[model samples]
Target chain A: MTEMAHALRVQNLSKSFNDNSVLRGISLDVATHEVVCLIGASGSGKSTLLRCINLLEPVNAGRIWLGDEEITRAGIDEDRVRQRIGIVFQAFNLFPHMTVLRNITLGPREALGLSRSEADERARGLLERFGLSEKSDDYPDRLSGGQQQRVAIVRALAMDPELILLDEVTSALDPELIAEVLNLIRELAGRGMTMVIATHEMSFARDIADRVCFLDEGVIAEAGPPDQIFTAPSHPRTQRFLQRIIAAGRM
Target chain B: MGDTKRSAGRGSRLLGNRAVLVSTTSTILFFIAVAVVVALAPGSDIVGERFLNWVHLKQSLLGTATAPSVAEAFLLNVRMFMIAEAIILVLALVIALVRGVPGPVFFPFRAVAVVYTDIFRGVPLILVLYMIGFGVPGLGLGYVSTRSDITYGIIALVLVYSAYVAEVYRAGIDSVHQSQTAAARSLGLSRWQSMRFVVLPQAVRRVIPPLLNDFIGLQKDTALVSVLGSIEAARAAQIYGAEQFNYSAYVVAALLFVLVTIPLARFTDHLIARDRRRREAGGAAPGALGTAAGAPHDVPGAIG
Candidate 1:
């Protein structure tokens, strides 16, 4: 709650794609090293909020603070802000034309102005930690769904970002492969990495998140600790949504 | 099941043999029939003397004392094509990138790119050649205007061909998904950096076959520079025909042009075939992405 401890702050963020508003009047705050998860259905604006926070998608109305700086202010350097925040997408979105090492090293070498050897050493270390050193020379398409997603995470980690945003990182993986990616996220959480994850995995969210926000329509309908949000939900829509998830055996 | 599979394979092989035999025999017979008809035509002897004279063909290729050899003159066409093609590749990509620049601040640059492509592509290459070839020299700007006609020809080819090539590059740039750009930008790379490293490499790879197609057209259009009396292959052939009153030199020139284009055409076909194979193979093939330039690339995690 203290301003000095805040890692990210979004105040009344709104975004629209033409006539369809994706995120409306959404605000949330994450403390340093704390993990927050955004849980919602298909059109619940979780992905939009993450994208807006990363400045990949410009918000229609809002202000966002990264650490001490107001990132949404006019004339702010988007590249510089993005350098401190890493994002892993649902579809991986690895550069198909680059090998895993190159994909991981491209941002540090190009944006951070790290020398080739420095970037390579950093990338290799992350790859080793993630069990992807063997696939460093291989392209993304050559890897399995799980391996590709893991490489994507390593790509974000290569920048040594202060905060990371993960948007449904397991949504595009096979059911069997989903566990590997979730385990990696759990490891990052244990390491005290500040993370904002938007996910459909009910159990993973419940286990790892310090706080959970249930988004409906374009706003966060409810926010609380995962146990309260999941087991003793207060809102009818939250109850209905959890009922659907449990009935589908997704929890 | 094994016996049936062996028999099916043998059956297919037999059918393939019969198809090859029948087609080969029919092709031979068709060529023979055409040759017989042409040889028996009433004006065959005169036509052969005028256009198919072996002696004149040899003379034109080797060159007489008065006229430059068609082969030597073709070196000029080769020079012009090489120079123009190189300039077109770089210039067209710049124009394409400029047109793709976002924000109202780049409006003027994008407008210039649009008008450039429109004016150049809309005008005929021949007209462009004439205007630049004659028009630039007419300005009489001292040393600048006094440059050789071939220089003007090369410039004209670059201008016209770049417009078409720019559109080809733009199509390629558009074909790359927005997600790729988003991923790059999110990694803290600037928009220009994202374009240079991620988008341009992929775009250029995907459009190689089409870029080669444009190059082939440019190679042939090098002949149009002869309108300025540059004495390239076509012009040399024209001179030989006029002096000797034999059209065989034109045949020699045509053959030379085809000779240069055939290898490039075959190379383009090879690239297209390789791209199709990679796309159909689910992009897991060795050396598929980046090595041979990514083709379609499995649509990014689409397999799952």
Candidate 2:
């Protein structure tokens, strides 16, 4: 991928919460249709960084450019930028009061100003793609964790975002349910949806990510092709982190 | 397995029967005691005169041949009370929503709401009406002083009930999961938008049954407006009965109250039953999971 074709770019991004900096001067880039996996220990700022990229958490400093639009600058149309990017949370935040179909259609209808029939048609098609056609009328609370997470992805995809942010999408699921969510994600990656995923699933990152980033102490420790990042990481901190995670089978 | 099932079924049936018997006997006993006290009380003539007057007035209000002059009295009273209660519900709902949004930004608003609720809830409803209808006018609030009694009654109900409704809203907002807020934000909804579209709807759903109960309370409380002598349903009946030395007027007023309150009570019961069904069908699994997750912490401190 060429530099000009990057889907998202972060430059000197920093964020603090109540005087404590959670992300400090982090910079990264994702090429169009590329899958980048962010792997790190707790409190390492991987999640914070993902949130900043999606503008779910505001950055204290620096710039985030999504294609030609400058999202990090104050007074930028944040909603417009957000419309181009979709985010899925670890908690599978499907609205409990809404049926699965409504969950997927709400953002599209409200943000994009799509008519109800059009939104419904799009939602139905997306749910069918996610193999959740039959569950469209059911509430999120009725779904298995894996199924809910998949519906969450479909909800995001229905927005037709240019880029998607996945924040530990499988972490809240049962061990048996994790694979199904991850497999759905892997399929999205295969279909060329530009994605930045914060995950602990080592095998997924190794298999699906075009580039893997190891974040530590609120900064990227190292980033490279999956093979190099996994088997031949140059940073000692990255190696130690990988060893600990692998030992815990949290990879 | 069949024997265990049979035993469990038998035990459940016995417990159910015992509960039914206990409730029925308690109710009957309570009525019997009330009747005995009323029958045996002193000042029988004065009490009987007052009682009979109330009854006669009520019967006249109910269109009985005993007193036709009081029929319009009952209708006017019922209309005024119903209007006042309706105003109270609407005002309360609005106040509750404004005070119920989560965050420090809403803290001062919530504090004010809490103070309002405490003051009104602590004060007698009659006192509140007197203050609003009489005291405010004395303070040169011309609009209030010049307004009709029905208008004053509605205003008083709105002011007092808004506070209670705010607390109900606060409770409902607090009941929604924190994760839902986070999820809405992640979806790019502004804080206000998220609360309006996502959290508030869910919170309102959870608060519906309680809201209905509050409405019922407000309905009964509307009778207090009669203290202001506005000729609301109860006061209208009271006036006719006192004049004619008949007791039916009070009975008529009581019946009117029953007519309004009984349907609301039954509706509340239906709401509660529906809520329970929803909980049993969808909530039980989540509840079990939650308890299971919490159970480990409880085991070490168990007495056994």
Candidate 3:
């Protein structure tokens, strides 16, 4: 892809938790309006990479660029950078004290400095679009796991972010409830939103992602379209990992 | 199956009735036995005449020509408690927030908060009362130091209780999950904004029971201010006891203290019970994160 089309760029990213290294000198480039899927087993640095990109966890050594802005440099306003990107976690961390409308409006009103009426209008529109307008006054604990996850997605979308990160968004839901969240992600993908999703749903990744990167032991061992990676993988580790997934009937 | 279920329910109700009967009999028998033993004691009449004299109780509550009314003097204790409680709430929250500030930039502020809590919490409340009550006035700072001894007593109370209340607030803040802060920060709220909007509300709600517990102690400690010779209820009772050579006035003062605090204690219990029920119903979550709003049961006057 051309330099101007790059939505996010990371160079030699490395992270560690004290003595245990997670991401080891990883490089990634995501293009505009592109949906990239990060697939890997647990503890393979998938979540860490997403947290690093959002500046939630300070990187030990790395440089991240968001649309030509060097966000990792000293004196960069991390809070302003975070405002431009949205992240949805597995645990739907909606402020339980707040109603759905308040949770969605907080970021917009606080960070963007929108008037209360303006924030409320924008939040209501997103809630209606996500089929949650009726539940806007309810607390998150009152919602089902699936409905809460959808509200979380709507919460992120209310920010009107340039890029969104999804970290195992469906992993916490019941199997029957996973479809609603997956459908919402599919809708976002259809609308051409730039996203980097770390997920374990093999089939959903195959359907929604334009490019799939299989992370192994802290690095992307294989990268390609879903058809090539799933049906005919080049790397031995990729083949082995897919075989296990197939044996487990997850693919 | 329906017959079995009905019989089982009847059996439980019968057992409950039998339990109530047995408990009532034992409680009545225990109280009767204690009364007989006390009536047979050698000094029972003397004790009763000295502490439970009905005429003296009446006179002590209403005050006499020579002594101030214990009831009226109690208003000073109530006033001191209310002012000190309000100041403690705000000052303690500030101290807690200062200690919670992160990064090296706030190191000095955090250090001051630490030293403050440590000093006040470590010192005895009565000693603090003595020091500020006597020492500040002893400084002779003109008009500033020459204020009423009641003012010094209130300051002492605020200094000591805020330390305790600050720890309670810190515990509540720590009980909030780190994920909550992460979510707020990821939404681009500054650290202070996240704390102000997201953290403090939840923290304050979670610690209300403990905060009330501290306040109950504060209510009783209002009597400590009498050490400054402010003539509050306890001091009034002391003067009456010395004049009449009877301790019945002390009982009157104790009853007055209990009259104010019992309602507050019940209110705190109700808050705790409601919070527990909400948690059990919410199942794993702390439930609506606790609204710091109106209490279901109105606790008479003089308390929020």
Candidate 4:
């Protein structure tokens, strides 16, 4: 593959919670406009790694580069770094008190300092794209799980970030609702939005992922194209995990 | 059909039970006995004289005006009580916001707040007023000028009510869901900004009804200012009734209090109903999601 320009690079990323080491010397790189999937069992440091990428959870020791921003250095302006990265949580953490329109507009208006009219116009366009135009006035509690998660994606997109990190976006939804949210992500991947998703929806990953990295015990056990990773994972742990998840029809 | 008829028949039999009749009759008798005892108790002649003397003392309070002494007394009492209660509420909210929640740096502040609340809540308002109005001056704090009686009464009220209001605010703050804070922070809002924009707005909404109830309590408790010889409404009524040997003045004062409290109580009830409706509407939308997923986790837990 052409050395597709690097959008993010992590070297020696490590984190420990008291006696428990959550991430151990994890190193990875993602190309610009690429969709990378990190798949792993529970407690394998997938979520922690995602959080560390945005400096939401400070890593114990590591270097992270978002383009050339050098995010892991001491006294890095976190707000500036965060402005470039958008994250969506499993909980669909939409501000409850705000209307769907306001929820999508808040970060852009506040962080990007967009004028109200501009923010509203951008937010309206995004909502329309997500098929949530009619639900703008309603609160998150008013929306279905699939609709709420889709709104969450739009909320992150409104920031116009260089990269988006989605942590277990479908894990919290019903089986039927999961497909709708995954479909939205798949659409985004097809449009080449430079995304990193930690998900158990293996079928979507197989279909949309440009590359897949299997994380085991705080490190990437294997990383390759979707075809090789799914059908011919070289690592024994990756093979076993794929077998268990496929058998269980979830991970 | 047989089971339904049998249950209905059993319900009728229970309704006619003698024990229920005896308990209802005894409750009525108890209230009647208390009323009779209160009515037969010594006439207010002795208390009437004392009340008259008190009224005379209050008449000179604002210094001999054409304002009916009774009206003047009532107004003065009300003014003093309102001033005191307002100060108490504002101070209590500030204290609660600063020191009520659990935090390392606020531990000492919280401890101090607890002690302050305990001391005032533990002692009677009358005792607090007496100390500030009379006791301190006796200790060469110098007879607090009669002009300052209203001020002293307000201080006393603040000291006492702040404790109660603080607890009310503490409960309101604690009621906010931790997830709201987490969500706000994850969105990159600083701690104070999260509190200002998110938590406090919701917390304040939840506490409004209780805060109004506390206000009504404070209004009624304005009677405690009487111990300090302030011309508050209740004291004014008592004094006027004593001098004239007519209970109408006291009744008028009670009516005035009801006038102030009733509207507020009604407004509070309306607010509570409106809030409930809003919550119900917010929750109703999630039921649609329920059908999509057998059980999607609802916004997990009570919002502040």
| Native interface contacts kept by each candidate, as a fraction | 0.75, 0.25, 0.51, 0.15
**In terms of docking quality, how is candidate 1 classified?**
medium
Model 3: residues with Cα > 4 Å off, grouped in runs: A2-4, B1-25, B283-304
The interface root-mean-square deviation of each model, in the order shown, is 3.7, 9.0, 10.9, 6.8
Residue A129 displacement (Å), model 1: 0.8
C-alpha positional error of residue B264 in candidate 1 after TM-score superposition, expressed in Å: 0.4
Which residue runs does candidate 4 get wrong by more than 4 Å?
A1-5, B1-93, B100-147, B241-251, B273-282, B285-304
lDDT on C-alpha atoms for all candidate structures: 0.93, 0.78, 0.90, 0.78
Query: Model 2 off-target regions past 4 Å?
Result: B1-11, B29-74, B85-90, B93-146, B188-193, B244-255, B284-304
Tens-digit lDDT string for candidate 1 (B139-233):
99998789898999999999999999999999999999999999999999999999999999889989999999999999999999999889999
| Stronger candidate by lDDT (1 vs 3) | 1
Task: Please list all clashing residue pairs in model 3, or write none if there are none.
Answer: none
List candidate 1 stretches off by more than 4 Å: A1-4, B1-19, B286-303
Q: What's the ranking of the predictions by DockQ, best on top? A: 1, 3, 4, 2
lDDT of model 4 at position A231: 94
Higher-TM-score candidate among 2 and 4?
2
Which one is best on DockQ? 1
**How would you encode candidate 4's per-residue C-alpha lDDT over B1-304 as one tens digit per residue?**
7876779878787778977899999999999998787656696455455433554445533323332455556676568667877677679988887774556978888788878988989998888988888865566644455436677777888888888888888788778886576555555555666676667766776888998888888888877778876667667666655555655566556667788789999999988886786567545433221233123344422221
**Model 2 chain A: lowest-lDDT 10 consecutive positions:** A135-144
Candidate 2: TM-score, chain B only: 0.71
Best by lDDT: 1
